[model samples]
Target: MPASDPVTSRPPLPAAIIAGTVALIESAGPLEDQSELVRAHGAQATRSAQFMERAWLLGERLGLPDDLSRWRSTIHLVVAALAVLVALSALGMSRAVVGESRSINAIAALVTLLGLHFLTLGLWLLSVLWPGAMSGLSLGRLALWLGARMPGERSPHALTVVRATNRLLQERRLLPWAFGLISHTIWALAFVLILAVLAFGFSFHSYQLSWETTILSSEFFQRFVQIAGWLPSLIGFPVPDPVAVQHAGAQGLTALTGADVQRDWAWWLMGCVFTYGLLPRVGFALLSYLRWSAGVANMGQPDSGDPYVRGIFARLEALDPPLVTDEERRSTHPAHTLPPRGPGIPGTLAVIGFELPPELPWPLQSLPVGIEGTTVLELRLAGAAAERQNAIQALGQIRPWTLLLVCHGASSPDRGTARFLRETSHRVEKSRILLVEAEESNRLSNSASGLRRWSDWLKAEKLDAIELVAFPEVGQENA
Candidate 1:
């Protein structure tokens, strides 16, 4: 398939983590400027699509995708090593069962084959029933930990990616299933190797298999063998009769030399291993895989509402140049009259200077005397995407009693400025626009005409509810 094909894309889980990692990185400090990316994708892209595209672009630039690839390779190597170790262990156990004496103790051999498997399987079950009980020390978690700690030239963001992946899996409750899937698969492989070894050993060599107990009576051994063989018998494997069972306990290694006796015992053992050991491992592995897959599919996308993500979207929105529409020429009569300044400015106010020229002083040096001690948050909303994004983010974090937006009185109001004001006006109890006149004598005539133009534009935009004021100089008398 071509590289750009959707079928060749990273799985949902990894894609989400990559995107989350990008968000984390950007939140810490800005990376490369994404203005070009915003321009390429434009405002028409969905938030999720834009986020994924940005993450992929930035992840490549920072070598995040390469880091993720390295991590995955390391995990695969660890899992392979673990599988090899398990197969070797199973081979050793099979050889031990038919030791120098060539005598297999039926009871001891069963325990040898399945004792550890059963213990670990029970522990996994306990962990599932009570989360954190096991501290997640499964073979799968071991692979992940070892992969992360493996010595290599890892990027600084590698650990961040790992953390994001783990957090995402844990939040979706898929961590246990992911670990269980690996553990069960390894165990199933071990069982498969054991079965192959046992079949080969039984087919070529002759070994005595009997039940021997020093403390228990023959009846106990008989009952134990009968009960253990019941399931195997249903599947056509032979279960020794009472007579053979009793004699086997009494005779020990010398009990059965007949071909019938040897064949029955061998088939019973293999049957028990298959029905009890291999089948369950395979079944549970399948279940865990299904659950893990479902979780990954439902992991979805990074939260668009998150502050950092929201800020990114805001920047992207700011990049799209607003559409310009022709308007009727300004009339001599004011379409909407400016309301008089109220009795007093609110005690808490947020003031934003929108697209003001560099020469204008911020945090106006002059104010009405009565409001000298009022709490105020002053910010500048410039033409740059970053500046607008910063302003929007800062304003989102607070809800003041009143919002005072200051604009350049000489510049005519456009759709962009009007859109910004309409969006931000709802974050406070009341909103008002202040038009600041420039000190340049050449701009005075334009400022006068701009005031009348803004009034008509505000009325057309249905923003007449927002109070408008005109400031004559840096230190104006108006509140």
Candidate 2:
């Protein structure tokens, strides 16, 4: 967008953007984990999320709502309907340009993206301001959208997942004083990983659009605009291009929205893996980070759970863990503690914080070998319990390690590591160790400073060797 564009003064987004943002929220982690809360709240939260998603579809596919259907009816409904129509019409103009224009040059692309964004923005406002007029939006709609390719039985845990996540956010579980920002940060970094792939395909690679250009390619770029298309892309933050001005367009959007855009195999590959899980992780991270940086502290107290605390908790419990509830706890069972932490610790930490693991069939050892360290333990655990046990065994009788970094979950990308740190830290304050989690696949740090980026509170508290673990992938084991 030009400096003087009419939208310059508009907030950070347009009409479609709002809807895109809301769509992104549907399966997002910090919120998806709210499924736990849904369980606690029965299906209210789950239903609510479902409702939003479905209502979005309804708006997109169906039309306006009832009271309006009746009163052409209630004043709010009537106005909302008209506002949506006008906004959607404006938004449609740009999309129509893309859909109609024979030219696929940069200018056209820009106009197209802007148009779609406005449409989405209008719908988004309608949903937020006149939600009652759009009550049909929901997860059930998503199920329908997935259509034939839909996964198996829906986990009834959606709502509980919400509750659990809310619990973590409320508790401010990850970040600052924690380890294994791995899972939590995944949501944010996953897109980065996807971007790296696209970049590798086009931007940084010797080539321009092959393997590296996928994320920023034509298909991906337009999707970045369309509400129906933008969710995963936005969640990923997968840059369209590297340069902002010059040829890359508003920031890097130019390169992304540039001419001859095409959706190739690489784009689809990244989209599938990243969208299903990684992108949602990124969304949650943003939500948590938002709360953590500003929202959490504003609560005027240290004890209140940050918005992400509940999310993290839900993620951990999703592991089907061998958890001992307060009721199940006995005085005799010894609690597991972490390795001690201190100022001079040698281990360094890093995050290859990107989207999905390298494409399938990429051997573990042959996969990207990020920054180096004295000890490199590649954890390819299938589930959280396996990872927890591995954590214990890895640090159990080990030496004066300088760093501890974990690989992303070996299977699908749904597992979250941030939740693990939060739950564990609450009950154990031994040896004193800090935890930080991230997505992506690179990071090379010595063991010493790893604790530093982790947290002073944790270090000062003298916690034990922290175990940063991730939950299991709930979808197809083979998918």
Candidate 3:
């Protein structure tokens, strides 16, 4: 049997995006790890495949009971309901446009129907040229607002997902095509409903269709009808003859119009809506949807030199076993501690701080061994990825020496700290020790909840080779 195609096996686009987002949220390591996976696999494959991989990973992580798939289902229902709502709204507008008059103004209705759409399209184009200035006219915002208020099961989550996905893609400068897809779709649906209601109005109601213009003439109207009805006439829609056009223009329906002439005018009006209004909207909607799909398939390939793109590449680089960076050496022995000699000191020592408290003095004095010449490097646990990477690289360069990671015992261990330790372990072969320090007034024992939590994390990472030391009241003693 032949193997199934990866694209065919993957879920739909909505499902893939939602699943990938959930994977980012539930990832074991830092949120960056999921992005790293996207960059790594995406380098070798299409973005669609990378998206599929993320969905697969989410299923693997969350198992059979995951609710990510519910987001896609909810979105489909919401979109269907929106289409219906748009149709209903358009029906009301169509009735108001073709109102309760004994004689319908054919020129007014025709111009109003086509003119409004043209005006909207022009404004949409202008807004694209000058974004934010006309953001109030944005269809994406309208869509989001409607989605949030949609009433249905799980619709809230689906709408939230849509808003989040749109914002994220917008930050990456990829939302225009996607938003266009949605706008054109709504427009098409509205146009279709308006046309349907107009068709029904003409069929059931008996009314005279005439053109009344005090500024125009019979000759001018004859020429206008000839030009405007050219396309509709070609498609078999009945066009009024020059005599009937002159009669409608001169009499303004004061004389009784013939049934055949009225039928001809009705067909012409329906044809105008079909050709000029509905057809163009349908075409634009299809084009925009195609553009959005193309964007989704190629989302991994962002333009060069973009900061976010560069950041993704940096993540991919860090995924490799060996990475290089700059070096630095700094130390401050502001105050030295009376030596409490411990057996765990290596031949050469390096002290690295991870978000150490500002109150902790420089060249930490609590080390059981004397550090007369050892290099000391301080890094905040909450620092940028580049800073952490640089610290790891600097430590790797000075190896054959054991490394001590000093942290404040009062702060709880978090995933960020765990990720830093894991990444650092991959870079160097020396003994990696963890030193937790707090004022000696605090208890230091394995039974202490804070210390036990750190112990559990270390065991989970399988980095138990190094010692875990807690400095109790050492700060008070030194003072």
Candidate 4:
């Protein structure tokens, strides 16, 4: 398989739910070992594929999938409800301005129809340009909030899914676009309904349109009417001229007399609403939809390189038998060789080599520079049980604040090592494991995978407090 084909992509929502469930489970405690299960069910799959399958299996067992489905259904229902509310609101505004009266206050009607829409649109734009600027309650956010809580008892996994989805979208700066798409679509629906109401009203009903403003001059109204209608006029919508503007203002509360004047004012009002209100919303809604779609398409799966993920992969790899074999092997160095005593007396730090390979150096030539104070004891524990017991007894006498336990990276951690670590750790104030990589020809452990395996082993043994350190390769250290 090609490199990229190792793992398959999943839809954004389902992927988030599964990944979130995995995180929740891992956070709770060490998961039960799944080596046998993976070997049986996913033996031929790539490590990434196996990991995703494992996550899905666990998510199913936890009921996250069903919970997420219910939450999503609630969101859809709430969105539909919001759309209906916006449409009714638009219809009410249209009728309130032109319903009972023969003459319409054109400016007041415009404000009533577009004021809140424009305010919200402006805030949405601000949020896009500068994140968190429009952090206040919005229709889209309100819908999500209500959806999660309403309809029935809340699912336990609902919050986790939300947090996961938010985290994923926030990383790509797509959260605002997701919410904005909903807001703009609802606004667009409102505009369409408003236009429909206006067309029906103007066709069947007879009405006069005029502007009433005490302080403003007729010249200002004329300029406003012309400027506002320019774009709409270009698209073949009627715009009332200066004569109509002055005539309307001069009439004040009285209706404009001529049929032509009334017709011109009515169409111009509809034209401005279409041009300024509907068109902008439609355009922005399309833009938001495109962004949201692209974000989902490119959303990433869980990272394979993450330590937690690597740990899972390591366990899966362990289930496979070794493909190569050595016909002959020999051990030239002795099992246990204690390092000679140094000049200084025992210090606060004790360095012990646990089951180190015979070929590797004893009486360590170098130590990590970060570790402070003199080395109190350098004991090698290997071979017979007596030697191991002796090392543990020496540790009790020194009682160093920090104990550095060195081990070969290639060696798989066994029950013996776990027990020895638990016993020695109790004697010291703190204990750390340093894994030294062998030469390339003799190396069995891949650095990252090895560290993660050790980490997982430590967690399983309830030795999570002990830090696992990866030492530089022996050749690199000498170089």
Candidate lDDT values, in order: 0.71, 0.34, 0.59, 0.72
Per-residue alpha-carbon lDDT of model 3 for 291-376, expressed as tens digits?
A: 66765665433334744444545654443333224334333322211112133234656677777666555555456443334554
Model 4, 1-479: lDDT tens per residue? 22332134446557555765667657768654342234223423466555666676566645677777887898889888878888888889888876977668887787888899889888888888987766565455566677777868565677776666556666678878888888888888888888888888888888777788878888999999999889999999988889878878887424556677778888888998999899999899899999988877664355777788777777767655444445354344233222222222335888888888887777666665455666788888775788987887687666676888888887889877876776666567778888775563233245787888899998866678898764455677699
Once fitted onto the true fold, the runs of candidate 4 whose alpha carbons sit more than 4 angstroms away are: 1-10, 28-30, 33-48, 151-155, 252-256, 304-479
Clashing residue pairs found in predicted model 1: none
Cα displacement (Å) at residue 328, model 3: 34
Model 1: lDDT to the true structure: 0.71
CA displacement after TM-score superposition, residue 394 of candidate 2 (Å) = 4.1
Runs off by more than 4 Å, candidate 1: 1-10, 26-33, 36-44, 304-479
Question: Is candidate 2 or 3 superior in lDDT?
Answer: 3
Clashing pairs in 4: none
C-alpha positional error of residue 170 in candidate 3 after TM-score superposition, expressed in Å: 5.5
In candidate 2, which residue ranges exceed 4 Å CA deviation?
1-332, 336-339, 343-380, 384-386, 389-412, 417-479
Rate residue 237 of model 1 by lDDT: 86
Model 2 Cα lDDT, one tens digit per residue, 257-311: 5343334222433453355445544554465456455533332121215333344
Q: After superposition, how far is residue 71 of candidate 3 from its true place, in Å?
A: 8.0
Between the candidate structures 2 and 4, which one is better when assessed by TM-score? 4
Write the residue-wise lDDT of candidate 1 on 1-479 in tens digits: 01231113556766777777776687678765443254224422455565566677667656777888899898888888888998899889978876566678887898899899999899888767876777656655666778988998887788888877777776677878888898899999899989998898899898888877778898887888789899989989898888887877788546566789888888988888888899889999999999988878765465776787777778666554444454554444333211222333446777777888888777675542232334557887777767875665455555566777778877788767765765465455677877765564212223556777888888766577887754344345243
Total backbone clashes of model 1? 0
